[model samples]
Target chain A: MEKFDKLTGIAAPLDLINVDTDMIIPKQFLKTIKRSGLGVNLFDEMRYDDDRNEIPDFVLNKPQYRDAQIIVAGDNFGCGSSREHAPWAIKDFGISCVIAPSFADIFYNNCFKNGILPIALPQEQINVLMKDAQKGSNARMEIDLEAQTITTSDGEVFTFDVDAFKKHCLMNGLDDIGLTMEKAASIDTFEAAAAQSRPWV
Target chain B: MSPKTLYDKIWDAHVAHEAEDGTCLLYIDRHLVHEVTSPQAFEGLRMAGRKVHAPDKTIAVPDHNVPTTLDRANAATMTEDSRIQVEALDKNAKDFGIHYYPVSDVRQGIVHIVGPEQGWTLPGMTVVCGDSHTATHGAFGSLAHGIGTSEVEHVLATQTLIQRKGKNMKVEITGKLAPGVTAKDITLSVIGKTGTAGGTGYVIEYCGEAIRDLSMEGRMTVCNMAIEGGARAGLIAPDEKTFAYVMGRPHAPKGAQWEAAMNWWKTLYSDDDAHWDKVVTIKGEDIAPVVTWGTSPEDVLPITANVPAADSFTGGKVDAAKRSLEYMGLTAGMPLSDIKIDTVFIGSCTNGRIEDLRAAAAILKGKKIKDGMRAMVVPGSGLVRAQAEEEGLADIFIEAGFEWRMAGCSMCLAMNPDQLAPGERCAATSNRNFEGRQGRGGRTHLMSPAMAAAAAVTGHLTDVRDLM
Candidate 1:
């Protein structure tokens, strides 16, 4: 996991709604256990042609957005499948942030574990960010996790809320397993007591 | 002490540890695994030098990527990469001392189907799987939800998941379902009323006369689509129907133990005066056979309704609606049945049970599939396939010009060769209607198995009641 406090980078606009995990990283690319190298297959069906050539019309395929580090997308961004590979693909592709009007629950949590910031803002603010993102590589967006704010190149700012524990974990580069291990004694005690009280379970 | 909802009772019983920030470690009683998601988790375990702490509690099956063709009876003949994934699970399970049902096994099927059928998913247990439809187990009065690969690894290594509890919601459906309407219709109707994201952050409990009257199979069908409605899980209190279904399965407790288990399961329901964070009620009589007109599950309307115009929607959904109409190749105000389809699919975790197949067989007995339209039926499990064949349901399907497929999640997500060609439209009995879920540019109209059977014989989405 990578530590996060702030980032300023070019944001690409993906204006589609309900961008499902299947569309993010299709099942064909999910066979491998390794999370690395999936950056190439992100949106495999839409980004590449039958011959494996890049489709020039797709948002990420455009010259200016090829190396984008952020994405401004539509609502319910990661709607299907509980595959964590979706976040791995996005992060492996150099995308550190995803700004949407709203996000599906699992995907939103998965983003935090993988060091990707999934920011949910009101539709009006998302509309402003979407336009700012369409300005291509010239317009860099700044995200300050410490201050819970996203700032555009043209001086517009949007504030967002994140769970306190999640914010702390992102700032400290900690994950669920790591956090759980911190309280290993309590878990062990609870399990031992449960064994005695609910032996049949 | 405050009165506890069914969800609160389950949550309280499963907590292994709680942190100051409201995070708690919930112990999982059962963990179901499939090919697509577990390989990475197994790899993570290997990398971390950890072994499965409780292998007996976990079960694995390779259903997603395995081919359902009768010729390739085994997973050995699948695509190279797919074969590797299947074989990886087999090897990993053996190495970790976990039970696995490979494609060659007669017991093999979708993880969600196999678990309940084998009786590993019991009432009062907490089940977790890597597949979204894991909520299917919740029908047996369990707390179940899909977890990510990282969490899968954590559970395998620790037998517990770190999480915050979800809000409790009760969706009560009263009145009797109209003729030809099934549990699938009731669920679709709920999703239509509440948008796809409506149940987010909540664990929904399905209650009332309609829900209690449903068979165990029908209850599974309803709970299976809980994820589609954005709910963490959906549950039904265990009853006589649930116990009857779990009584004599392979993994179920026997004799004296069974009696003990039954008594415990009987107490899993909520009290009459229990409180919930949200309570929603719908009349079963009002729900009709449904078809999805757009990309999301929420973009649905009754089969009798016409396609909605984009301008009919407000907020940020107008653009989404317009795009969905374009992508679906549909026009505003056109009747749903007027949309022609090239194929019909009658299988998924949602509607591939014995009763579902029986319903379809009843409709297709003397009818033939429409000319130039392809139709297929894939049973939920090998057990279901064999039972259908014994009842001569498969014969009716084959006699009606529909291909009778061997078990593995045939065309649900199209991880294998079974899929629709681009631009092909289908009337499917699957849960999702998302873009490219079946295949790129492949249009899907979600319906009941009976409706799918009717569509196969009509070449379009038709209300099952019309044929009945």
Candidate 2:
């Protein structure tokens, strides 16, 4: 897993709520187990038209927001169907931070796992960020994972709270299993004790 | 001293050890696997030359990539690419000696459904899966949750997981649910009120008079949305209802063991004096037939409510809602009843159960789907599909011009050629309606199964109560 220090890029405003897994990476793309290669088809249906051509009206196709690395979206940004692929595709597409009023449970955790910073902000704060995001793709926003703050180009700072344990894991790139391995010695001791008592090993 | 909550009791019993970082090593009793995420984990195991530590505790099934209609017949006819993926899962499970319910097995369906139906999800167990809906097993008073592929491999090699403790949230429903209201409605209303992320970093314990009245299936539906509300898991106290639901299943205890297990399960509840980190209350009568007007699940209102105006919210929320309405081709202040639909889908893990099907069938009997509207009924599991057929509900759907298809996650995510055409709008029973959740540029209106059926007959978002 890559380490996250800071993310500064163009802000793209999807402005839609409940943007679910299917829209992030349609079900057909789920045929393969490989997590990579899905970014190209992220939002495939909306990104293209009946002729499979880029729909110029879609937010992703707007020339100014084409290279957006930060997504400022509406509330409940990743709801419906628990597919980790949604975060995987978003991360692979170069989106490192997602600022929303809320996110679906699974997709929010998956974002942290995949090195994306999903910031859950109050609706009032999110409104400001979304406006900043609409200033075209070049409207650069900065996110400092260490400081746990997001700043806009206009010098506005927003601080959000994260779970202490999750924050530790993200800072050190430790997942559940990685956290376990950190205590490999203690686990070995317990296994040895259980084996001796039961003689099943 | 703190009185024991159901979560505390379960967590204490399952703890194998506590690490230096304060994360506990949990002993997992069951691990469920599916085709989409398990292959990489299996490969990781083989690379390390490791054998499964407890094959009997693990089970595998194929669902996500398998075509719902031909899951049985076309198990061998998969595209060359998918064929290899499916074959890899089969071989991996075989080599590890884990129980594999392949497509050919009559028992095959969604992994979560198969586990509980087969009695593998018993009380006092900790279940893990690579799929998030794994929380469905918590209906049995177990600690069930989704894990990543790496953790899947780790559990395969060692049936244990490192988990951080979460705060306890008690969501109590105080009043009786009115007739025509179901567990789906309650959960949808909760999501709408809680803003989808309301339960983050907590284990939600459902209680109160209304929750106790719900059947085990209804309880499962409530817990199923725990993930949607940002909770690690949701649980109900184990009572006679929980015990009766599990007794006599193939995987459940029998004889003296059954009696002993029952005694243990009886103690799995929060004491009268137990304290919770957070408590939220909702009156059942306040909930209505919820329908998502925007892309998010939280973007919902009662079926009779109008689309929210842009000025209703502060900041850019108004503009964002406006943009979503434009993409969805809906106008502000338009009555939800005025939105016409091109398709209707009534199935998924969320609402694809026997009761959900029965609900839909009741509304569709002797009724015809409106012209120019296509409706599809996909059961969540093969077992559900068979039971619906046996109950003659399939006939009602077919007679109503709705497609009666085999079971899998069909049209839920637009996988397996089941998708809405670009710009098409659908009234879907499944969980979401994000932009293109059904297909590219496809618009979705999330509703209950019965509501979806009503929309199919009306060609518009009509309240199910109106049809009732």
Candidate 3:
């Protein structure tokens, strides 16, 4: 897992509600076994036309937003599907932070697992960030995970809350499997008790 | 001691270790695996050189990316992408020593269908799958939910999941269902009232006369849409019907073990007066046969309603409704029954059980689908397909001009070859109505089996009761 800390990069505005996982990478692109190399197919249908030509009107396809590392999106972003590929594609596309009014629980957790910061702010705060993001490449937002704040290009700053343990893991690049393994003895005890109590399982 | 909700009891029973921060290492009793989301998780396992923690607890099948036709056995006939994904699952299962149902195996089908059918998903257990619809098994009184690939690999490696407690919600359905209304209608109506994201941060427990009256299959149908309602899982208290459905299954306990299991399962319901974060009551009589008219599952209306104007939605919803209307090709004020469809899909983890097949067949018996309409019934599993055939339901579908096909998650998703072409409109028995869910530019209207049959026979969205 990649460690997430303070990052300064261009932010893009995608003001659409219910931007589901299928819209992020679509089911067709989900066939890949490897997590790498999915950035090119991120938002495939929305970014491409019938002829596979780039649709310039789409936010990610726009000239200045092409290299966006942060996304200021609408409410309930990543609403459908438990596909981790959604966050995999987002990170692969160089976006490390997503600011939304709210998010579906699964997608929000998956984002943290993939080292993509999903910040749920009030819609008004999201509106502020969305406006700053529309300032093209010049609007580079600085997110300080340690400080728990996002600073816009114009010096406006907003604080966001994240779970303490999840925040610790993100800052340290701690792999969850490795962290869980440290408690293997406890797991073994639980399993033994479960086996004796419910032998059929 | 405080009374615990159904979700709280199941969640507490599975907690292996809890940190002061409220994060708990949840013990997972069952892990359902599939082709698409799992390949990367298995690869992660191989990359890390970690062995599976409990191979026997895991089960695998290929469904999403496989062709539902006879050519499934011939990999050459499938798209390269689809073939590779399915092939990868076969290898992963073998390498991990997991119980598997290969594509060529008659037992093979959608993972969720296979799990409950095998009794691998039981009451008082914690079930996790790589797919969102794993919530289907919660009908058995388990705490089941979907996990991402990272968590999939975590479960494979540790047999435990990291989870925090979610709020508890009670959706109480009162009154007996009206004639012709089904569990699918009840679920769709629930989502329609709650809207998408209404169940976020809550594990919803469904109870009441209407819910308890449903058969095991009907309960599964309602629980299957929990994800679409933005809840990670949904639960129904186990009863004699649930026990009867599980008894004598391939993986179910027998003899003394069965008695012990039942003793615990009988206590799976929420205690009377258990505290609830939220409580929603729905009168079953008010739930008419419904269908989704827009992209989101929440954009549903009773069969008799007209297309809602975008302006009818307020706040951030207005633009979403407008976009959905544009994408679905629906005109404001248009009667829902007047909408025409190019296809009728009767399958998916959501509505592909044998009971679902029988419901559709009842309507199509001694009748034919509309002229120029194409309809297909892809059962949830191979066993479901066989049972439908044995019951003469398949014959009814075939005689009615509906294609009776092999089982898999056929047209509910576009990954399979059974897909809608661009600009095609469909009346689907599947859960999702998201744009391009069946295929690119494909518009889906979610409904029950009988409702889908009605649309098929009438060449439009006719109320199933009208046909009756």
Candidate 4:
């Protein structure tokens, strides 16, 4: 629920397509009802070897990408299995924004819910950003959530489209429930009218 | 005047009020719950000291955390942590007087499957769940979708939800589907071509002759991928086939009520003059048994097609495809048939129905899984598992060197102990083949159940048509 104005972070290039829910947090981690602490084991199988040691070759383990808050990934990121935990883990891991050529349907919405900005850029635009991310951990990308634009270190600017309603939502941190509560006065009025008409209350 | 489409009919019927911000307050008819996302919602409810407004409208099941084995007593003890999670759901549901189908119950399975089979998902209803596959219930011509945990709690307390309006997308599949092609193939083809995000912000209505001919189960398969294709939901008109499928179920209407229900259901279709915000038509013949060659569902090609060359796509997609190929340990221009697999998985909500099992078993009859290929068959539901066994499919799978296991979301999400070792490549019937979808660093190739069976027998991605 943290308000987003401007976010600046290192780009972690996951680069994998269909990084599904199971791989995001794994079903084993779902055992804990708590959504917190999953960031540590995000992509556990790839993050750790059989001996539970960090797999140095994994993108997340590289010293440079370890602190990445922006993830520049390939197409159809977050595909397979509809588990919201995938977004929860990604958000918990400090990834505030995900730039991809595309993303799975459910995961894309779930990202908005968890306050993670998922940007769907064209393949060419994503390639430029991915290369900027791979330039090393320090290659910073700046996202102005208020302006709805993402700028790479090389000064390439991309304006992605978001639903006007969803844009209003991210700006005000209003989810479905939050939006409903915003109509408290009207809801109260309707309830009062119904109670008077039906005498049910 | 706009003619009524099924999407509009359902949406209008469920709209309680239009709020100032243009969002609608929808009356939820059914709310399905599972272990993974309900705990926090339950905790929130208790913190607020609220009781469920409509307990009968809600149902819970344990799926994601349950182990897929008949030795439930042993499987129950496998994960102490998930056991506590399931127990919490059970306790919360009991306290709220909400109906819950626990793991030990024969009726327990994925909530989406159990809801429709039990008639909880009837036409003219609005269903919501904490899981995205909630869209699967839209097969019954309902406005169904997934919500977050906070929204889950809100629905539990009020039996109403606030939802943004979605644009209507009519995806019409004209002409007949070729013999041997199924609804799964049609949906996979659409999703693969559109990319996973193609349907975002849209309510996809499956129309035209091909969709109309599909059975309820087949329709469910199509709707299940609505989420994958980025649609809020996918719906099919409730015709006689739909009415017949729901008529005698436990929760469906009976006697005179049934007649009234049919009248309403009949009117849920799009009128001949109805228009949609977007319309797309695909010839049924253009679809084939698809397989994911890269990390995304969109990274797919026909079973007979070669891995795409780098120059085949526009923009930088060629490089992206090339990178995916490298990570998947595949080479461009290689025949998909030549790629070997280490495992074959034939289950998930996508293709875990009885028909899918029959399709795979038909191919595996008298055929043995190739040496060094580990294969397993996990049914989507206990009922599916039982039916497969009664038909002796289990014995065939066992005899063919395949593991016939009990039903849960096993290996579908690589949760629990059912996961491929690192570096393993599997031909999977379930949706998605993202990097390590099966396990850490595990590679997955998405295919049909019959195709997975074919791969099991060949130790490579062989065309299922060859087996046919």
Candidate 5:
């Protein structure tokens, strides 16, 4: 888990709705057990042509947006498939925060576990950010996790909401497995009672 | 006190601990694992110096990366990438002491299908898997949903998941389904009305007379697409059909334990006064055989309708509709039935049961599919494949010029050797129609098995009723 207190970086705009996990990291790249080396294939089909050449019109392939650390996207981003590879690819590509009008449940939960911030703003707010993000390298936005605000390059500020526990974990780089281990006693108690009552399970 | 819904009862039963912030530590009763998602999770566990807390409670199967060809011994027919993934699952399962169903095992199948088949997904349990369709097990009155790889590792090492409660929703299907309509139509129709985001924060409990009338397999089909409807899970109350489906299976309880399990499962339904944050009512008679015309599952319409113009859509959907039409190479206002297809696929966690095979076979009996078009029927699992063969459904499909292939989610996501070529439009029975889901630049029109069979015979998207 990487700590995410604040970040000021270039923002890339993905102007599409219902951008699914299949588009983020296609099924072909899912063969590896390791999470690394997927950044090259993030949005593989959309970013490349049949000859394996980069499609220059894609925003990430543009000179200024290559190192974008934030993505301003459309409604219901990451809607299909419960692949953690979506966020793994997004993080591996150096993007830590995704601002969307809404997100699917599984993908939203996955982002927090991987130290990425998924902020859900109203459509009007997203519209504003989406417009600002088209400025390419000039679209620098400051994301402050503690203040819960995103400041655009032109000084427009927008506030967003996140679950408090998730915010706590992201800010501190907390390891969730270790935290769950701290409650081993409660889990042990539940297991003993459950095994005695419903032994078939 | 407020009456508890079916979801509330299951949630309460699984809470190992609750924080002051209302965060819950949920005890998972069954963890279904598959090759594609577990490799990374297993590697994470090994790197962290952790041991599986409850190996006996977890089950692993090789499905996603498996070749559907009959020569599956030692993964001989698979690509190098697919073979390594399947082999990784075998090694990880052995090293962690979890139950592994290799490709050669007769019981090996899609994780969701195999769980219920082996009676691992019994009623009144909490089920989690690394795949989105884990909601398929909710048909048995269990609280089931998908988890990310990180959560997979969490469940493996702790057998507990950190969680929060979801809102309760009821999708009550009223009246009787008209002839030619099936459970797949009901799910597709529901998604059309719900717009893919309607059930986002809720665990929908599907009920009413129509739902109660469905068999266990039908119930599973409807619940399998709960993810496509934007819900974490969907469930049906356990009935005699459910009990009959689970009794005497390898993992089901025996004798007195069975009786005890029955008593508890009987109580796993919503109370008469259960609270609901949202309720969607759809007439079963109104739901005709349906198909998705666009990349999103919500971009669907009844097969009797025509393609919709982008301008006819409201809100942000207008842009999405335009993009979808361009990607599909379809024109607005064209009759859906007039759109020809290059291929037909009939298998997925959504509609790969024996009943699905039977429905497709009934349509294809004594009739050959239109010439020069490719078609295949990949059963959900080996047992499903075997049962289809025993029932002569496989013979009918073969006689009708359709490929009778091995199981393991073939062409559903195109992870295996089976796939569509670029620009090849297909009439598929899989759940999602997302862009490049089947293959890069490929197009998919999602439909029921009977409808897919009709398309194969007609060389276009023909309504199933016409064939019947």
Candidate 6:
């Protein structure tokens, strides 16, 4: 896990709603267990044509937005499927943060686990950010996870809510396995007791 | 002491420890692994130099991305990428000392179906899988949910998950289902009401007369789509139906152990004074043969109704409906029954069991598929396939101009060779209707096995009641 703190980068605007995990990274591209190679195939179907040519109109393919490190997307982003590959692809593509009106629950949680900041903001706030993001390469968006604020190039600011525990983990680059191992003694005791009482299960 | 809802009861029973920040270490009793999602988790485990903490508790099966055709009998015959994923899982399971069911094994099936069928999913347990449809195991009164690959790795390394308690919801459906209606219809109706995001942050416990009256298989069908309603899991109290299904299975206890398990399972229900964060009630009689007309599962309507106009909706909903209608190649106000389909897919984790196949077979018996229509029946498991053949259901489907394929998740999504071509329309017995889910530019209508059979026979979205 990588620590998420303050980041300033060009933001890309993707205005499609209910952008599901399948659209983020189609199932066909999810074959590799390694997370490193997925960036190229992120949104493979939507990003490429039959001849494997980049679709010129896709937000990521546009020359100005090709190096975007942030995404201002539509509501209900990552709505279907629980593939963590969606976040893996997004992070692998170098998009450190995703700002949307809302997100599917699993995807929202997975982002933190994968070291990507998923910021849920009001639709009005997203509208302002989306417009700001359309500025592409010339403009940069600043996000401070510790401050819970996103600042635009023109000085507009928005705040978002995240779970306190999740915030601490993201700041420290701690994964759940590391957290669980912190209470290994408690786990051992509970398992021993459970074996005596609920052995069959 | 406060009375606990079914969700709370099962959740509390599984808590290994509770954190000050509201996180709980939930000890998972069973871990279901599939080919598509386990590879990365395994890679993470390898990278971290960790081994599975409880190998005996995990069951691995390769279903997704495997070729289900008869000619592609082995992994070598599958596409290079698919074979690699499946091979990685096989190797990982072997290396980790976990039990695995390969494609050559008759026990190999969809993880959700295989868990219950093999009795690995017992009452009052916690089950997790990397697949969203893991909620299907909640039918057995277990607290089961789909986890991200990272959490899958966490569970493998620790045999526990750090989870916050989910809000509780009681969705009580009273009255009996009408003759032509089934559990699939009830679930679709529920998703339609709740919308895709309605059950977010909640674990729904389904109760009431209609639910109690359903068979175990039907209950599984209803619980399987809890994720479609944005719920992490759905629960049903354990009863004789659950006990009956569990008894005599490979992993189920016998003799003294069975009696002891039965006593605990009987006590797994919510008390009369149980509390829930929310309660929703729908009359079972109100449900009909339902089908999703749009991309999301929540975009459903009764088969007898006409498509709703996008302009009739408000705000962002209007745009969404219009976009969906455009992708589906449908017009507002068009009768659902009038929308012709190009194919019918009768299989998936949602409705690919023996009972589901029997329902479709009854409708297809002595009847041929509509002219120029393509239809196929893929059972959920190899055991289910054998059972269907034993019952001559496969013969009926084959005689009716339908392809009888081997057991695997065929046409549920486009990972394998079984998929719709561009611009093709299908009546699918699968869970999702997401854009290009079946194939690029493919359109899907989510419905029950009987409804899909009816559509196959009529060449469109026909109500099963009309066929009856």
Which is the leading candidate under lDDT?
5
Worst 10 residues of 3 chain B by lDDT: B68-77
State the lDDT of candidate 4 residue by residue for A14-126, as single tens digits: 76555566567766676667667778988886798778999999998999988989888877677655566777788789888888887766677677777788889888888
| Steric clash pairs (candidate 2) | A17-B295, A17-B296, A18-B295, A18-B296, A45-B440
Q: Tens digit of lDDT per residue, candidate 5, span A1-201?
A: 999999999999998888899999999999888887888999998899999999999999999899999999988888888899999999999999999999999999999988899999999999999888888897689999999999998999999898899899999999899999999999999999998877878
State each model's C-alpha RMSD to the native.
1.7, 3.9, 0.9, 4.0, 1.0, 1.5
Candidate 6 CAPRI classification by DockQ: medium
- Superposition TM-score, candidate 1 onto the true structure: 0.97
Q: What digit string (tens of lDDT, one per residue) describes model 6 on residues B307-342?
A: 999898775678888889999999999999999999
Highest DockQ model number: 5
Q: Which residue ranges in model 1 land beyond 4 Å of their true spot?
A: A49-53, B74-76
TM-score of chain A of each: 0.97, 0.88, 0.98, 0.87, 0.97, 0.96
Model 5: TM-score, first chain: 0.97
**What lDDT does each candidate get?**
0.88, 0.80, 0.92, 0.80, 0.92, 0.89
Fill in the DockQ of model 4. Answer: 0.31
Candidate 2 vs candidate 6: the lDDT winner is: 6
TM-score for every candidate vs. truth? 0.97, 0.87, 0.99, 0.87, 0.99, 0.97
Residue A133 CA displacement from its true place in model 4, Å = 6.0
What are the per-residue Cα lDDT tens digits for candidate 2 across A7-30? 888999887765666677776676
| Segments in model 3 whose C-alpha atoms lie over 4 Å from true places | none
Q: What would the per-residue lDDT of candidate 4 be over residues B1-468, giving only the tens digit for each residue?
A: 679788888887666679567767777778999888888778877876777867988998888767776576574445787778878988988999998888777787778778887888998788999887888898899888887676787788767776777888999898888766778788888887776768877899998899998888889989987887878688888888888889898888787677767766778888888878888889987777778888767777888899887678765466667767777988788999999999999888778888888888999999899998889998887788888999999988999999887777778777666888877999988776766667767889987788899899999998888888
Q: What is the lDDT of residue A126 in candidate 3?
A: 90
Q: Can you give the lDDT of residue A43 in candidate 2?
A: 81
TM-score of 2: 0.87
Q: Model 2, A131: alpha-carbon shift in Å?
A: 7.5
Query: How large is the i-RMS for each model, in angstroms?
Result: 1.7, 4.3, 0.8, 4.9, 0.8, 1.3
- Candidate 6 ranges beyond 4 A from true positions: B74-76
Q: Given candidate 3, what's the lDDT at residue B303?
A: 93
